[model samples]
Target: MSVHFEERSGVVPCKTPWGSWYQTMEEVSIEVNVPPGTSAKEVKCELGSRRVELVVRGQQVFKGKLFGTTVEDEATWTLEDKCLIRIVLMKANREAGNCWGSLLDGQYSADPWVQDQMQRKLTLERFQRENPGFDFSGAEISGNFAGGGPDFSNLQR
Candidate 1:
């Protein structure tokens, strides 16, 4: 797990129905890259064995699952605010190998979710480049930008 991120500023850790997560209220510089033809409304997320069910204000929106080898896990979807994705992984003392693995030597091709995540990340990078001074603190589905956001309901096929 080699996750490299710049020092985030004004970030506060918060908890949701799924688990504890963190976000920054300030415009922190996050060096990232996205794929081509991807829009800003998407986010590429990678997780472990844990799978999450998305809910908004107590309403169910989407369900998620992780795919990969026993050592690595990966998934992707559009970014949304106020939407929580619950990850369900553990069962009967058995661990689901979804999020922990060596990505360097792991399988990265032929995984639909991984591709989606990559596209979403690229979209985010483009969004950051376009909006040089805006904070991505509240970029979830609930929040709306001046131009437009990712169409979570509609994904590229």
Candidate 2:
């Protein structure tokens, strides 16, 4: 239940056992960490019934699960001194929202979608870093292979 961070995106997962989740009269706030120099446009957040996914640089990084309370779609995020992304989620059931367990203490892992997208994004980012000045965008798959099996179609987009 320790807090963990993915170095690639510098994402500090929310709702981990390490995070503090508390509810006020109308909202629940969770603190997260993002990379420095992360512009507002570079970060994309998606809220589901129980999970919150964050997409940065076209990479799915942090996916946090809200165990008890249902969160509203509209969320507010503010930047801290050293690139901390604080997200406050609106509680669907505000009156009894305080009846939850400890917020911090469980493993925080991204969802399957985040895993898939992050794999591709990290691979591309690594390739770009290793091969500077290479036109990765123009690179083509010759379509001629031994097995003719899975290709980089998923990695393309």
Candidate 3:
């Protein structure tokens, strides 16, 4: 006989006389909402040159393949104490094209991680300009954290 293939939605599942094989699942766009009782320490997010992965309780829950742009090291994870976890990505280049709204897209390029970074940078600059009295001596100078972001949480003080 000949070989045949079937496609559905965004994936392909091939069925043969012996068994069946399914293709990889689609990239996860949107925010990953984990179940209740999830701890911050239990959740792990891995950011690569062009992709983002999330693992909770030892299981890979979400994955997002980004565009040509690079992501910043400082990803803001605005999570609750012991409930849900929320995060925003920071794109490297600010003068590029339109950024992706969601995490995953059917196309080759998903999203760009930039908004959060620019916002934080601007906010921090504004605050420092307005309140020069505020002491920022405890902050460390590192990778993308040269001057530091607006949020003071990262500061050691």
Candidate 4:
């Protein structure tokens, strides 16, 4: 899989199923809206496509997913502006033989023993306050994040 940030939309893009086919789902997008008085280091996890975008406002935050089953495992913060956002998708098979369909969550967690959560949410507010107009992107839903896009250095890291 390949990952990078797009300049035009200020969002990150992650392409998967390298040199192969996965399913019918597209790429995912995760956008984090940085707020004020927040630090960049607070926010963890490399944002990808899955079309998941986490936005932070004054006292409320928004998060969602775009592709397959989403795991709820993630990072924790001590700040007040930070919150949890999870999106899960499942597919069920309908057959009448030994080879039937099954429903399962599709996500890789950071912990080897667990397959629930992966990344941690940071204080986007701090990052935004320090820098302005930070460009960000996310991963694709279920397809490869293919692109011949431009470089992203202007985005406030």
Best candidate, TM-score: 2
- Model 2, range 1-157, lDDT digits (tens) per residue? 4221122233212245324343333455666566777777777877665667766668766666765555566667766764666677765654321322333224344445443333333343334444565633333333222222234545743
Worst 10 residues of 4 by lDDT: 94-103
* lDDT tens per residue, model 1, 1-157: 4221213222232222333332111111112223344343443344334343433334443344423222223233343232433222222221111222112133212244443333333334335545567643235323332123353435554
Most lDDT-accurate candidate: 2
* TM-score of each model, paired residue for residue: 0.23, 0.43, 0.41, 0.20
Q: Model 4, range 7-56, lDDT digits (tens) per residue? A: 32232122121111111111122223344455534444323333233333
Error of 1 at 39 (Å): 42
Global lDDT of model 1: 0.31
Model 4 RMSD to the real structure?
Answer: 18.5
Global lDDT scores for all candidate models? 0.31, 0.48, 0.43, 0.25
Comparing 1 and 4 by TM-score, which wins?
1
Error of 2 at 93 (Å): 1.6
Between 1 and 2, whose lDDT is larger? 2
For candidate 1, report its TM-score. 0.23
Ranking by lDDT: 2, 3, 1, 4
Screening candidate 3 with a backbone cut-off below 3 angstroms (N, C-alpha, C), the clashing residue pairs are 29-104, 90-113, 91-113, 91-114
Q: What residue pairs clash in candidate 2, if any at all?
A: 1-105, 17-104, 17-105, 17-106, 18-105
